[model samples]
Target: MRLRHITGSEDFVADSPYVVHRSERYRGVWNRELFPKPQPIHLEIGMGKGQFITQLAVLHPERNYVGIERYDTVLMKALRKRESAEAAGCRLENLRYLSLDARLLPEHFAENEVSKLYLNFSDPWPKARQANRRLTSQVFLDCYTKFLRKDGTLEFKTDNTGLFDYSLESIPAAGWTLLAVSRDLHRDPVLNEGNVMTEYEEKFSARGNPICKLIAAPPK
Candidate 1:
């Protein structure tokens, strides 16, 4: 999908307190410096429009949430959504955004800094040659393990069957333990509980698409 560039989006993010403009500088101190108090940090990669992360942060005030998005336009939209929520009297003190590439996660976070990671409807780099680019690929999983604490969980949800199958194979291959797997997330009585819907999840599920989900933890 070609994203339309929005004018002043970068400037907007720079001025917004909700965005961590100089994320690299905060590296190991994010939890202590950003949130009101030190708490378990949960990160969501590719947090489009901020629905899931923002809502999750609101629901779980004890945990801090950081959303990472690469595109300026999309990140801007998420910022706007957050502003709208604030306008409606929502206190989003535990939430923040980072405009950065996922590959640089290790540079911006210290080892064991993140307690949980969320991947929702990520792009399916379907072609075999592009498998390395998949978020659940072995390469990315190794990177995730660096910052994710021991026993920390990575939860993934997607509507793409091919990506789901690939993740099921890639996760364990990277030596992570698959704690739970759901081919149809919404229908899974246990996994579906407390599931926050992203914009994509709501749209696709409304069209009768079965959402695939999984939870994996680093090997002890």
Candidate 2:
């Protein structure tokens, strides 16, 4: 699949007021000192338009959140939501955004730094050759295993059956133990209540497509 160019509006370097450094030392210093407490460092990869993370930050003030979206054009929307929340005195001190490729994830996070990782409605990348590029591919899961805490869990949701099937197989191969799998997220009212729907999730569900959700935890 061809990659689209990210616009300047969503460029973190160009738009984010927070210090977004890629250096390991810089990340350590910021996480330890700059950010408050840093107890629950949950990561939302590919946060499009910011609706989900914004709601999460608003509702859960105790857990710190890190949103990573590479596409600047799409990322700007999430940033705006954060800015608005802050302005309104929502005081979501636990939220932040990073603009970079997931491949560079290890560079910015220390070992066992992340508690939870959320992959919400990432691109299907429908072609056979693009399978390796899927967010839940073995390569990416391996990266998560390196940075996530031993008992950490990965929550993945998508509307694409093909991608979901591929992930179910790939995650286990990468050494993660699949704990729960669902073909229809909405049918599970308990899951639905806790979930903060993404822009794509709403759109897909509105169109009557069943959302596929799964949770995998690292081996004990």
Candidate 3:
């Protein structure tokens, strides 16, 4: 899908303090540089308009949070959302945003640096030829191990059943363990506890789509 480029989005992110420019320099020392002090780091990939991760940062001040998005236009929107959230008196000192591709994750984060990882409504890349492009694919799972802690859990939510079924098999085949699985997230009290809905998630749920969620962890 072609992204609709918003005018001047580039200039917006360039001037924002919330954005981490030249993020590669902070690799292996995120806590030492980006954050105030060392703490558990939670990261969200493909943070659309910054709803989920931003709320997580506000809801859990004890942990550091980072939201990554590759598109400058999308990242710009997230930056604006951060400003609005701050205006409403949200303490976001522990939150940061990065405009980078998922493939570059290792360039800005050290091995075992992330305690929790989130992949919310990522492109399923349904075509069989595009399996490797899917965020829940085994290939991507192997890439995540570079920065995710051994016990770190990855939470994925999607409305696609095919992708969820593939992920159920992909996780174990990639040598990871599935900690939890939910077919209908809103109906599952345990899994839905404290759940923060994304901008897209709300739309999908309103249409009566049964959101599927899975939590997986890398090898110990």
lDDT of each: 0.93, 0.82, 0.92
Alpha-carbon runs more than 4 Å astray in model 3:
none
In candidate 3, position 33 carries an lDDT of 94
TM-score of 1: 0.98
Query: Whole-model lDDT for model 2 versus the true structure?
Result: 0.82
> Taking the tens digit of each residue's C-alpha lDDT, what string does model 3 give over 138-209?
788988999999989999999999999999999999999999999999999999999999998999999999
Give the runs in model 1 whose Cα sits over 4 Å from its true position.
Answer: none
What does candidate 1's lDDT look like per residue over 169-216, in tens digits?
A: 999999999999999999999999988999999999999999999999
lDDT of 1 at 24: 81
Q: What TM-score does candidate 3 reach?
A: 0.97
Q: Assess candidate 1 and give its lDDT.
A: 0.93
**Best model per lDDT:** 1
